[model samples]
Target: MLCQLEDDWTLFTLVFAVALLVPRSPLRFCGLVAALYVLWPAFRFRQAPPWNARQVIRPAGDTGSPMVSVIAHRGGGHDAPENTVAAIREASKNGASGVELDVGFTADGVAVLMHDDTVDRTTDGSGELSQMSFFQLAKLDAAAKHRLRDAFAGEKVPTLEEAVEECLKLGLTIYFDVKGHADQAAAVLKELYMKHPALYDTSVVCSFEPRVIYRMRQADPDVVTALTHRPWSLSRFGDGIPRFSSLWRHRWATLMDVLLDWAHHHLLWRLCGTSAILVQKDSISPDYVQYWARKRVALVAWTVNTAVEKQYYQDVLHVNYMTDSLLGDCDAHY
Candidate 1:
C-alpha cells in the first residue's frame, strides 16, 4: 500500500483511522456487524496466476465467433436496473460472458450490490444506503425510473452472497469492483474468501486505491486485482503527464495511446520498483497505453460497449483485456 497502516487491526483503528479520517469509509462500507450483515467482496479469482497462460489474440474476423465472455457492466446498465438480479439474469440470458457490478456496505453493516452511497439514482428510497437495514432496503424498489419498471417493481437489493449464488447457478465468471477503503474492504473480502473458495477463480477486486490493491495482493497475490486510475495516480510514475493535449495535439498517436515514456521508466524505477501496472485502458489515450506499455505496464480497459471500442482495444490498442458490457464481444480466456 502506498500509505502505511497500523500494525494491529482493532476497534480504535476502525473508529479513528477509518471513521474520523480518510472520510470515504462511511460512504463506502455502510453498515457494520459481526456476521452476514457486514459488507464485503470475494477473493477467489486472485488465487489464479493471471500471467501464467496469457492468450495471444487471434486475427480479426475469426468471423466474430462467441468465444470469450462478454462482461456486462452493472448488469449491462443500459438494458435494465443496474445491479438488480433481474438485470444480471438478463445479462446471462443475453449470452454475456460475465457481469461486473459495484458493491458497498450498507448503513447497518450488511454488504449489498450498490454503486453509490445515495440510493436516489437507482431506487425509490432516498439518502445513504448505509442508513438502512436489509429489510428496510428490501422494502424500497430496486428498479430505476426507466422503461424497466413494472417488470422489476419489487426487485430486492441483492446481498453479496445472493449475487454469488445467482452467478454460480448461471455458470458465469465475475469481476467484482470493490469500491471502498483499504483494510476494512480487505477484511470484508477475506470473510467472503473463507466462505467460498470456488468463487475466487473468476473474480477480481478492482479499485483506484493502490493501498487496497497492494493489501489484497499481499494477502493473496494469485487473485486478480486491477488498479483503476485517475491522472493523479500516474503523476509520480513520471510517464503520466503529456495528456495536456488532444490526440490531434498530441504526438506519437498511432496505437497504445501513449500514457508513459522513457522519463516515466526512470520515474517508476525510483519509486515503484517495477513499471508494470494493472490499469483500466479506457480512461487513457492510445498514446498513454503505449507509454505505459513501454514502461512494462500491462493494460486492461473498462466498459467497452461497442465494436469500435472493441477494435480500439484489440486491433489498434492491443491491450491485455477489454472489460466490456457484453460477453460475446470480448476474448480474454486466461
Candidate 2:
C-alpha cells in the first residue's frame, strides 16, 4: 500500500498542491509536515550510495580480490536452459564469475528459480506458476524447449534453496532477482540468510519493484539490495499488455513512464536504500555513468552479449555486466 502511494506521482502531486493551496491554515501545515516526512529519506544520509565501489566483493574462488565483472544472465541461458541448475553449472564451468537467479513461488509456497509467470515458455507445461504445486512443477522438464534440450532433457525446476546451495558450492556470487510477492520473498530470504550468514557478503537481492527492496530492508537492514531500471520499460519493452491496450491507455502509460523514470533517477534509489543500480545496457554511456558516479552509486549493466560490448563495459565503462552466455561469442576471460 505504501509502495503504491509512492509510485502514484500524479495523485501525490495533486494532493500535495491542494493541501498547500487550501485556504485552511491547519491543512496547509499538515501538508508541509507530510511533505518533509516523504523527503526525509533522500536527505538523511551524507553519502547517496550504500555500497562502496572499492569494497565490491569478489566471487569466492577468484584469485586476489579483483572484481568479478561478468555475471551470467538467467544462469547463462545461452549455454543451457535458463534458471535451471544445469544452466547455473554451465555458467560456472565456462568461467562466469556470478549468476543471476530469478525467484518465484509455487502454489504450495515453495520458492523456486523461474523467470516468467507461466511455465509455457521454458518448460513442457502450459499453465500459470501460481496455480501449480511443487510436485507438479518438479515433474515438468524445464529444459524441454531449449536448443540443448537433448543434453539437459530431464532438468527439473530448482527450488530457491537448491539453486543457492549450488551457487555457494561452486563459489559463484548470487543475485536473487525477485519478480513479486515482496513480503513473502523477503521472509524467505531472511530465513536463508539466517542459515547461511555468508550471503550477507556473497549475494544481493535486486528487483525492478522498489517495494521489494524497501520490504527487504525493512525485514533485514543488513542485506545488500539493488534497484533494477530500464528506461521507458512500460512504454516500450514490457509484457504485451500495453501493446494490446487502447491508444489512450498507451499514452497515459507513456506519460507515467516518463514520471517514473525521473523518480528512479532522482529519488527511488535513496528511498529504497539501494546499494547499486542495474541499468539496461542500451541506456549506459560515459555521461550516464558519470551522473551516477558523481552521486557515488555503482552502476551495473544487463544483457551485454557481444564480445565488443563486453570489452567496452570492461575497458571503457569499467563496470560489471550481465550476459546470456559465458561461451561462444560472448565469452569474457576472467
Output the number of the lDDT-best candidate: 2
Model 2 ranges off by over 4 Å: 1-39, 42-68, 238-244, 330-334
Candidate 2 residue lDDT tens string, 34-96: 876687645432222234323433332245554546889999988999999999999999988
What local distance difference test score does each model get?
Answer: 0.58, 0.81
Residue pairs with colliding backbones in model 2 are none
Model 1, position 306, has a per-residue lDDT of 64
Model 2 residue 267 CA deviation in Å: 0.7
Which 10-residue span in candidate 2 carries the lowest summed lDDT? Answer: 44-53
Worst 10 residues of 1 by lDDT: 52-61
Off by over 4 Å in 1: 1-48, 51-69, 232-298, 318-334
- What local lDDT does model 2 show for residue 216? 88
lDDT of 1 by residue, 102-141 (tens): 7778767777898888888878888887777877887878
